[model samples]
Target: MSGQAAIVAHAQHWSGTPYHHRASLRGAGADCLGLIRGIWRAQCGAEPEPLPDYSPSWAEAGRDEALWQALMRHMTPAFVPADGQVLLFRLQSRALAKHLGIQCASGAQFIHACPRAGVVQAPLSAPWARRIVARFTFPAVFDRME
Candidate 1:
C-alpha cells in the first residue's frame, strides 16, 4: 500500500471510536488530535515528541497558533491539498485553529472525530472550506511505505 493508502486505512479503522478529551486509544476513546496521533504511531513509528496536556479552552485562552506551529514542525506544508493530507480548521475566523481531520478521496471528503458523532467521513462542504487554515502532509519518510 502507498503511504496515502495506509493513512486512509488507518483512519478508517478508528471510525467508531467514541470522543474523549485527550484520549488516543482506538475504539476505547479519542479526540481529534488523538486520532491523528494514533495514525502517526501506526504509520511513522514513534511520535517525534511528547504532547502537553491541553484543555478545551487552551486555544481560546492562549490566542496563539500553537497547534499549527506544532504541525508545521512535523509535517510538510501542502499548497494543494491531496488525499491523506492533514487539515487544520479554525472554528471561527478569530479563533485559533483547534480542529483537525484527514483528507480523503482526493480532497472531496475528510474524516474527523466529531464530538457526539465519533469519527466520521464527511464531505468537504463550503462551510468547512471557509474554516480551513492550513493543509499538510506527513513527512516524506512515510510516503515511501508499502
Candidate 2:
C-alpha cells in the first residue's frame, strides 16, 4: 500500500459510520467534515485547529469560503485527481465550497458521510465530478510510508 492508499484505508474503515452534524466519532456518528476529521486524526494525530459549530446551510448563509480557506491552511493542493485526495465540492453554482469527500483507491469513486446514507462510497459520476472545486492532500502524507 502506498501512503495515499493508507489514507484511503483509514477512510474506508468508517464506511458505516452514521452521519451527525458537528460530530466526528466513527460508528456512532459523523458528518462529511467529521469523516475527514476522523481520517486526519487516524493519520496525522490532533487537528491543527478546532472548528466552529456550523449548520448544514452554513455555506449558503455566508459569502465567505471558510472551508476552502481552512483546507488551504492544513493541506497541500492537489492539481490532479488521485487516491486519498480530499475533494471539496460546491453544491450550487454560486454556493461556497462546503461538501467534502476522500477519493478512494480506484480514483473513480469517493467515500463520504452522507446525511441520507451515512458513510458510503459513490461513483465519481459526471454530476458529482462537476461539483468538485478543489483537491488536497493531508499534511501527513509526506511522512507516511506504504
Using all chains and alpha carbons, the TM-scores for the candidates as numbered come to: 0.91, 0.92
lDDT of 1 by residue, 67-91 (tens): 8989999999998878888999998
The global Cα lDDT (0 to 1) of model 1 is: 0.84
Report residue 51 deviation for candidate 2 (angstroms).
1.0
The segments of candidate 2 whose C-alpha lies over 4 angstroms from its true place after superposition are: 58-61, 142-146
Winner by lDDT: 2
The total of clashing pairs for model 1 equals 0
- Candidate 2 clash pair list: none
Give one digit per residue, the lDDT tens place, for model 2 in 1-146: 67798888888888999888888988999999999998888788788898976677624746778899999999999998899999999988877888999998477899998888998888988999999999999985543321
List the lowest-lDDT window of 10 residues for candidate 2: 137-146
